[model samples]
Target: MAKTKKLAFICYPGQETFIEPIVREYEKRPQYQVHRYYTDQQADVIAAVKWADILWLEWANQLTAVATQVYEIKSKSVIVRLHSYEALSSLPTRVNWKVVDYLVFVAPHIRDIVKMQIHDIEKQVCTKIIPNGLDIDNIPKNKVFNMYDIAYVCNLSLKKEPAMMLQIMAELVKFNPAFHLHSAGGWQDKGCEIYMKHMAKEMGIEENITYYGFVENMETFWPGKGILLSTSFHEGHPCNIMEGMARGLRPVIHNFIGAKGLYQEKYLFNTVVDAINMITEWSATTPDEKDYRKYVIDRGWTKKSMMASISKLIRLCGKKA
Candidate 1:
């Protein structure tokens, strides 16, 4: 019988959305003993690090920075996955890169940003780009396509650009008052929330927008929506865009950094006018729903593809340990 290796996934609480799926996959395999340590306690962090033969740190945040400084990790292989915020923040500067065997990046632009910020990152660790993936096979494709109905799913924050979203909605309502926006996700910034409410009423487009707060089950919520709109300043392989696309919803994403590399030109928009034109133009032609879903499949952005690559990397790291 093969020896069972200890694997620990460490991350801060409430940030385990991406790591949870990977942990479920490893639990089913016999050769791995999986443990998820979601805490910031110094003693607990050290215990988890010492117990595992391999560590998968979800974010290159404070938890990871502290974990890398542990003495026991010298004998254990480590993989740190940096999403987006860490690259822009000072957290990456504090992380000890020499101890990390594999540095996984969700997008190429994020990797490039981190390299520029942290000197000799490429030479210190083996960097890999693995875009965020969705479990496409299980996501039921019950799309209710309507050109007038737009869907927006994301936590409202300054970076999400809720103000820009309002501008788009205001323009859309002018084109046709029937144009409505259905928004999900909670507010992370109180100021943004206050501003969004005030601006929506001031702009006279409040009647055209409906807020559903934070939706727990998107499968049921997505059926009535037609178009998925993303107006973020930046993103690291946004799962919301992929989730909506998997459900056959046409996406109108902002031209954020690295937007063109991940999505087709037709799906991207730079300004409110550009977004208005894309929707108005698409409504005229009316492409098939299958095309949206096909884009995700062709790019190999399914959960199966993502897990396969991660699993191979895990095995390679384990062999080295």
Candidate 2:
């Protein structure tokens, strides 16, 4: 057996959700011992880094350590995964990428943005596109496709454009009055959720849009929804899209920053009208569940598939799995 190495995973605020599934899978790996450093306990972060053969800074943001502790990680192999928001924040500019053995990206769009925005990034900075992993096997296979019910999952935020989405939904009602939209997820403090609701009210489609704030079990939202809508101005490969697919909701995703590179053209759309047309087309001729299900499996979103990516990541750091 390979020597058991201690692995440190540090999670920042919003990151806990995306990091949990990966931590669960890594804990199951026999070759490595996993230590999860939830957030800012400076001493814990330092100790975890010291004890770890490889330190994985879950978010490129905080928990990767402030600049002072950043130097401590220079002696050890470090892996940092950067999501979309961090690229725009001060986080990327703060990191010393030279010490990082591997930089992980949830999607290519964010990767391109980071590369362009960050200053003095190491020429040899090794990067990998590891989409967020989910335990699909645990998500029960049940869906109630109410053709009129459309679902949007993700916290209401400027980037998510809840108001714009409501505007589109309002327009969608014109084509099909029975077309109801359900959005599950809380409002980010800066999201202007009230403004979005105001827009819904102004558009006179407030009743057509049902807001179920902060849903714990998202699978329940997918059933009875004919189309899953993703209108985020940007994203880090959201779980909702794949989870919606798991429940067999035909996905209608907007052209997010770099979504085209990651997803098929058939699913990506340029405008609300385009997405509406696509959903209409899907309704006219439904897709084979088996084919879409297979598509999700092949993309390597499952816990089993993610393990393979982790194994490769271990190898990249010159460790045995």
Candidate 3:
């Protein structure tokens, strides 16, 4: 009989983008059998835990109930990946570190912030900074052109600070009359959506702004964009930034504390004027698309590289625990 390592991933439903790639990678390997469990019912969660040798709770919040069930998680090696929003939630304080052998944070700043909030438990757990896998292999490198159409990827919610992009665009237009802002991703609330449109018109930049509601396939959407701009106040290393870089878009990331650690310092910005300047500078040149793509792949952020590392981590952690 062939030896098989059973793995169960319990994730919050909306985060399928992160989970799907890993699951696909595992399925390709004969040595692994993967099961996906969403945190819905207590009984189902327990059954899923019982079936797997390794259990990776995709969000710390998924462990809110499972952490309390000492017996259920006792036999399985538990690892939890914490994103930025969950670092602020009650879930961090509630995780049973004795049961969870490892904690994975998407960004170092998120790990640091959550450690401050969770206190004693943070010290007890072995943690690793793991970015969610991104594959640009299928995304052909159609490097940027000097003409201006700035793209910001992520949900158009209040938290992502889409309004900040508008503020930056207002400044960019004063210099580059052709500059436009493309906002893509689901708008969480209709009220927030309505407000953004109203605010853009009020600021007299409505024609320059376009809201693309929930991009279904990025391969179709990411091509030939001028620059990838992020105005998020908080992030766990935004995927849009990585996707933008992979698609050969110049990244203009508003400094979200530790984003400078993730990208070159030159790409980091503090003010709308700085963002406008970066946008203009990139527009006026031919960015080294090969360098950006290589940088992402070099960091082991690609689907295959990250999956291989993740499998190694799970097995190693399981053995150590």
Candidate 4:
């Protein structure tokens, strides 16, 4: 009989984009047998934990109840993945770290923040920082569009700060009237849509902003822009930012945790005004497309990097036959 290492992933519903890729990657390896369990279904999750050799958790908030059930079943080798928003919001939740063997942070800053919040659990939890990666072969090359168009592809959420992009666009239009902003993502809650429309109207940049809603083809959507903007308050290696870079879009992002060490110092901004100024100046003296693409590719977010980190983690857990 072949050795089988059973893995169960517990994640939120409608998060296929985040979970599917990882599952597909792991499934390709011969030694692994991965099963996904939705946190929405308690019975199914409990069953999965009982059968799994390793349990991988996506969100920390779901850990409390799930951990209790897993402990009752005596589940082994658990890994919890923490994102940026969770670091800010999930601190007060009653989390049981004893059930988890390792905590994965998408960014080092998130790991640092989590350590501060749960200092007492330091001995029980082992933390690892793994940045999000892109499938280089799948990312399409430039799908040419009109020049001077900026793209901001993210969910229109309060945490994403889409309003900051609108503010920056308003400033950019004064000097470059040809500049247009393209947004491609859906709003999860009613509050997001309300805030988004209010910000657009308040800034008088509503006309320049085009909302394309959810995009199914990121390869096509990403390559059609000259610049990409990220003004998020926090993030765990944002997939959009990595996708943008892979597609050859020069990113003009705020100084957030995951992006802090990735880009040049000039790209970092403390305020929206400063971000606008920097992007405007950079746009005027845009580097050659070849050079820009090379810069993004050189940074280690490829499939190899992602797999290496994941494999190392599995080995550390002493992968059982």
Candidate 5:
């Protein structure tokens, strides 16, 4: 029998939700043997790097001293997954870009921005654009469209612009009293928490807003909601938008990088007032739910689409069973 190829994934401790599911899916195949190591522990991380045929790291900030040690020890290819937060600022000079064989971006706009910032397009590094994918077969279908509720699933961070979402909901309440907003996801910084609480109270929309922090099953919270809103300043193909659309919820997103190609003019907004208008208009119109579901499934959220991309990436690394 042929030996299974060993693969090591190095990431921060709390990122298991994002990384684990993908790793688990890949490991199901008989050709691969996967091991996960948290970068928080230096010695264990280094040991895992030395033992694997491939190194996969998540987030630019999470790459610390341990990441450098991995590059030094491992002759295997290195792949870094870049998110929106990493592209917002400058990267450290000692990142050892030469060690990276491939850099994957979740959106094309993010890839463009990073290339402009680095200014070395001629470098030997390979860049791939792979948007976040959802398990469409598992997502429950919400047959009924309840116009009373709207939901936003993301971390309550400043860059996510939760304050703007609160303001939009505040204005929406006057026009439609039954309008309710549901929020889920964790808070990273103190400022984000304080701002979220202050805005909810100040806008007098606290009664209508339901906070379900850090949910494990977004499928339950996503369905039955009439419209989904994303007011982020930036994003690398947000999972929330994809998941919401899969559940037959219409999406109203700000004019950001990843959203440009996915939605139409009716769903795109440039400002708070624009967002309010767009949401209100979407809520009023009763579009065909089947059409919405079909759109999401066709655009890389289906099981087949995700597996094809993953297989392509694995093959690109020159690994064999």
Candidate 6:
């Protein structure tokens, strides 16, 4: 039998959604033994790091800073994955990048933001741009043909720009009162939640919008939704939009910073008027389900491709270790 390689994955509580799929894939392989440490417990974390030949820090947050700084990982290969929010925070500066053999960024813009903050990051660690991956085969493409039913899948936060979604819906209702917006995900910011709900009623879009708080089964929730909408001020390659696309929903993303770099102009809108026109145009045309799903596949945004890229990185790191 081939010798088994030990792997330790460290992240915070309730933030394992992105790493869980990769963990499961590693668990299934006979040549690997995976240990996922989601807690910030120092003793347990140190123990997990000592037990593994390779360590993967899921988010470049406080947990990663602590691990890379104090953990006795000189002999072990360390990989840090930075998503969007962490790049904006001060935690990336706190992390010891010299110890990190490989750093993975979900988007090029996200990497650039971090590079700006950490001037010598390029010389310290090897960084790779790997887009967030979706489990495409499992996300059933059972789209209910209702172009008027727009889907908004994101946590209610300041950066998400929730007000713009209401604006889009208000204009959409003007074109057709049948236009409805289905919003998923829990509220992350209380202030944003209060403001959004108050403005929804004030803007007369309350009746046209339904709040499905923190949907656990997106497979069932996505089938009836026709168009997936994103009105974010910025993003790091959102997984929700890709998931909706996998379900055959046409994506109507905002042309936020780096939006054009990650996605084609066809799916992006710069203003509320642009969004209204895009949705109305799609409603008038035939629904092309295959095209959306194909875009995801062509971009290598699936779980299998993600694992392959990470696995290749692991092998290279293993050789160096």
Residue 85 lDDT in candidate 1: 89
Model 6 lDDT per residue over 52-156, tens place: 888999999988888887647877899999999998888899988888999999999998888788988888899998888887777778546688888999988
lDDT of 6: 0.87
Cα-based lDDT for every prediction = 0.89, 0.75, 0.77, 0.73, 0.76, 0.87
TM-score of each: 0.98, 0.90, 0.92, 0.89, 0.91, 0.96
How many angstroms is residue 222 displaced in model 5 relative to the true structure, after the best TM-score fit?
2.5
Cα shift from native, residue 167, model 1 (Å)? 0.5
Question: Highest TM-score among the candidates is held by which one?
Answer: 1
Q: Report how far residue 304 has shifted in candidate 5, in Å.
A: 2.9
Each model's number of backbone clashes? 0, 2, 0, 0, 0, 0
With candidate 1 superimposed using the best TM-score fit, by how many Å does residue 229's alpha carbon deviate from the native? 0.5
How would the candidate models be sorted by lDDT, starting from the highest? 1, 6, 3, 5, 2, 4
Over 4 Å off in model 5, which ranges?
68-74
For model 1, residues 165-206, the per-residue Cα lDDT tens digits are 899889888888989999999999988888999999999999
Task: Point out the worst 10-residue segment of candidate 3 by lDDT.
Answer: 61-70
Badly placed stretches (over 4 Å) of model 4 are: 63-65, 72-75, 91-93, 143-147, 290-292, 318-321
Summarize candidate 3's per-residue lDDT along 1-321 as a digit string, tens digits: 856878888876677667777777777777778888765677767777778888878777754446437586776788887777887777777777777778888878888788677666666888888776676667677744444977778887788887788788777877867888777888887887898888888878899988787878766676667688898888886778887777777888888877877888888899888888787877888877778888788876777766776877887855743
**Candidate 5: minimum summed lDDT over ten consecutive residues — where?**
64-73
RMSD of 3: 2.1
Runs off by more than 4 Å, candidate 2: 1-3, 65-70, 119-124, 284-287, 315-321
Index of the highest-lDDT prediction: 1
Of the two candidates 3 and 6, the one with more favorable lDDT, higher being better, is 6
Q: Evaluate residue 108 in candidate 3 and report its C-alpha lDDT on the 0 to 100 scale.
A: 87
